[model samples]
Target: MKLSTIALTIMLGLSSSTMAQPKDITIRLVETSDVHGSFFPYNFITRKAKSGSMARVYTLIEELRKKNGKENIYLLDNGDILQGQPISYYYNYVAHEKTNIAASVLNYMGYDAATVGNHDIETGHEVYDKWFKELNFPILGANVIDTKTNKPYILPYYTIRKGNGIKVCVIGMLTPAIPNWLKESIWSGLRFEEMVSCARRTMTEVKAKEKPDVIVGLFHSGWDGGIKTATYDEDASKKVAQEVPGFDVVFFGHDHTPHNSVVKNVSGKDVICLDPANNAQRIAMATLTLRPKTVKGKRRYTLAKATGELVDVKELKADEAFLKHFQSEIDDVKTWSEQVIGKFENTIYTKDSYFGNSAFNDLILDLELEITKADIAFNAPLLFNSSIKAGPVTIADMFNLYKYENNLCTMRLTGKEIRKHLEMSYDLWCNTMKSPDDYLLLLSDTQNDAQRLGFKNFSFNFDSAAGIDYEVDVTKPDGEKVRILRMSNGEPFDENKWYTVAVNSYRANGGGELLTKGAGIPRDSLKSRIVWESPKDQRYYLMEEIKKAGVMNPQPHNNWKFVPEEWTVPAATRDRKLLFGE
Candidate 1:
């Protein structure tokens, strides 16, 4: 049995537990997923953030180990642990020339095994290879195979023997959707097989070879109600529980939502599956008790008792020692925050649902217009939180509000394409005609797409600012909601007019498909047009501009109306009249 990091810490106590007819060693599986390289207690830019720090998690892990002997514990990270903020980028691409904070922290903390997530490939495979080599424990992913070697670089499954001599075979699998969203270069020669097939084959092999006491699947794919399809779904955890035999406890990820439920499969067997929320904001601890159970013909041990908790980091104090050690790194982020990169003239805030001349959307629009050098440009309205208070804004504020780290791209659009884009927005409202009461209606329809485009942080809500006048008829299909009223300069939009539009690369690459299906100027992909600006820096400047222009108005413009334009045979759209019912 390999001695885990915790076990190595208290070797003397571990020996006693080892010598005595080892009692059932309670394996404290501490899982942190989608950490995105948040190791320090303070935000790199803010220098004062208290929540979602890796050091705090480290403190808890240490405390947990002191309470529960090493042989009784293991830590696992369910992918998306690499990319997100500037620090990870700085380390992976610039400063340290490495991206293995996960490996370093896990090495120090003694994580037993982990699975890869989608964002891990964002910095490219070279970084992954460099960092992966430094891991003391196995970074398991049976699904991630290198075509060059035709073998799994990371360990697929690991059999961990608890202090009581009870062996548990844990298999790790990354999300099969990696190739779909990741850059081609990172996963160029790689392939993500179906999750079902991966789970089936790996579990079968582990059952035959290891034949351990309990089977655990540390999966990076999310639970999608296990809908048997080309890939997995939310129920995937349950589906694996039902379909994949020999697995008792399953830890899932990628959704970044918390789900602590014990679901049973069709075989009259129950398995506990848990998904810890992202950002190390929450830690999931699952306690499993190994007990004997009978199969068809033989007696075997199985995971009998399973219970878990989502330990909020807010409840834990910041580990001052760890902060002191990483002080330089933390200070570097603060410096990055204070650097003035750009500026704006005055505030341009708005209240309309689509196009506004508000401080937030106006800045985005101005950037889009300036970058694209277009006569008119459009932007998505993001409404994550209420307006920034009358004070200085920070980078953390930008990241929190404009969570997506999207690449900048520009494109050429025709009048037809512009209409199509507006139509898409109209369709969004039309679809929610009946459910106008749902505050998060647009977010629900667009979150997955936005997240894929790394536009989670770029999200805006409430008012929309447009360069053209548009009317939406809720009675029509989604495509015909908005009627072009006029253009920004009060010029009538010519359907044949060619226009250049600046947007993030994600949007250009059919992010929301806002410009994809249009009978207009064929989009010309401009790779280096829109510069990726720092959210924090932008927000800080925005605060200054807001103060300069004390009184602001984000008034509503209900001038646009949705008249049925698509369906000749009008079908019941959202089963409602007003887009936003009074």
Candidate 2:
């Protein structure tokens, strides 16, 4: 009787399988990362028409949802959404009582899920915490752990069931190197785990709990090699996809470089990885198709095809509905942006900063020195190929002048440590100058490098010092290029004696590894090295100073210059032409 019952059950299962043909299931995930508050087709800072924005992105998303059933479409954002436009500032600081424009806009756009970016954390607990609560959809962070509760800080992963009964899961994580760049107070009670470790553990739980047919990874870290340590990598999305075995699609951002490729996991199964880059310029779309596979005489759904592509939002027209719906908010932002703070006597261009000193770079350096009263001030071309017209300097113009809300830090450093920091900076900024004809800048023509604010290296890390008279010799190599003669006060520079140096919080926090690796200061020991820290962002002080002065005239310090004029003069001229025509 037992043998007959087993035979009948097996026969009935086979008959049911033969009678019913399982249909193919599809799930489409569209992602945006590093939107950076470009919500409209206009640049609030420049007050001009820009190429891409969330308005334009909305148009494309609407069309995508229409073509593919809305039930099968999932919209996600990787991160870096809370900073950048003057409008964002208007909502973040000025209109603090109301719902943040970022959360409100995303809610209106119907974003299914999002991840908090490093920049979002920079807003501190007050802003990001409020923004986090305001979001309609769950903000995901598998690696962001709450130390108090010892649980996931946010919704680690979100799962949705498609109309065809295909369970799709999306996992989110940010880089573990947040502490290396941000202050402790900002990310208080939050600890970031390494991507691979978190991904592996999270995958195990997700596989057992959700039993998802399709899995997607939405990460905020770059592809590879941002900040490498023995324990963690700042950009480890690619590494996780390669090591973890479950993902069908992985989307990442924060490097601001577009990528669409495939990586094989430990199981030798292909995982599609996509990045849309920054500023709402593009959207990464991934499609997953699942088909039934016979396993042990039972049917199970598995990923049959996974594909990804980046769709450009630049060419798409802005949705009128989006603009009209938020017209009142846009007008309010414009009112705040147009409030004139000061005036400029002369026009300054950041393009001139690449070759050597420029009025724009000097203005910021001078501000740092005066504000901190330090012996030396380090400044970078944060503006990066922008210009300030010789006219009214409004709040909007300040955003263009100083790109980030980095606080000024005054740190104690020996003359030797200072020199080493500059060595690292110049190494990344300029070439070896093997010959006069060789490009002075280490220009990389690769697509990814060129997209980095028109420089081979990130221009924000191209730090130059004021209050010291120095010359960069074109004939020397990276470490030997800088030659310091004397301090600006004509005092003898001593490598053994400690001196107060002024820098931005980003540098002090080891944003570019200049302080830790170049200056030989340990990351944990940086706070002790600080002599003083500005109460607010350096830009705030700069604005106050400008407001007090009413009319500001900025000039290059000319305290430092390039040596071997025969080599430097021609190289600077030739390279400027190569970089920007005419």
**Number of the top TM-score candidate:** 2
lDDT of 1 by residue, 408-474 (tens): 4445667776677766654543343443332222323323321222222223312233466666555
Model 2 misplaced stretches (Cα beyond 4 Å): 1-22, 162-164, 292-300, 447-454
Error of 2 at 34 (Å): 0.6
Question: Could you tell me how far off, in angstroms, the CA of residue 447 lies in candidate 2 after the best superposition?
Answer: 4.1
lDDT of each: 0.60, 0.88
Off by over 4 Å in 1: 1-22, 45-47, 96-100, 149-153, 161-164, 225-235, 291-301, 343-357, 374-383, 386-402, 412-418, 429-467, 473-477, 486-499, 512-582
Native-vs-model 1 lDDT? Answer: 0.60
TM-score each candidate. Answer: 0.73, 0.94
Candidate 2, residues 1-582: lDDT per residue as tens digits? 999999999999999988797777677889999999989998999999998899999999899779878887889999899998888777877898999999989999999889989998888889999999999998999999999998898999998765666677889999889999887877999999999999999999999998777888999999987888999999999999999999999999988889999999989999899999999988999988889776788656887787889999996999999999999999898888898998999999988887788899888888888788899989888755789899999988888789887788999999999998988888888887877788888787654542464567888888889989888886787688888888999999988889999999889888888888887988889989987888777778888888988998899888888778888889999888877775
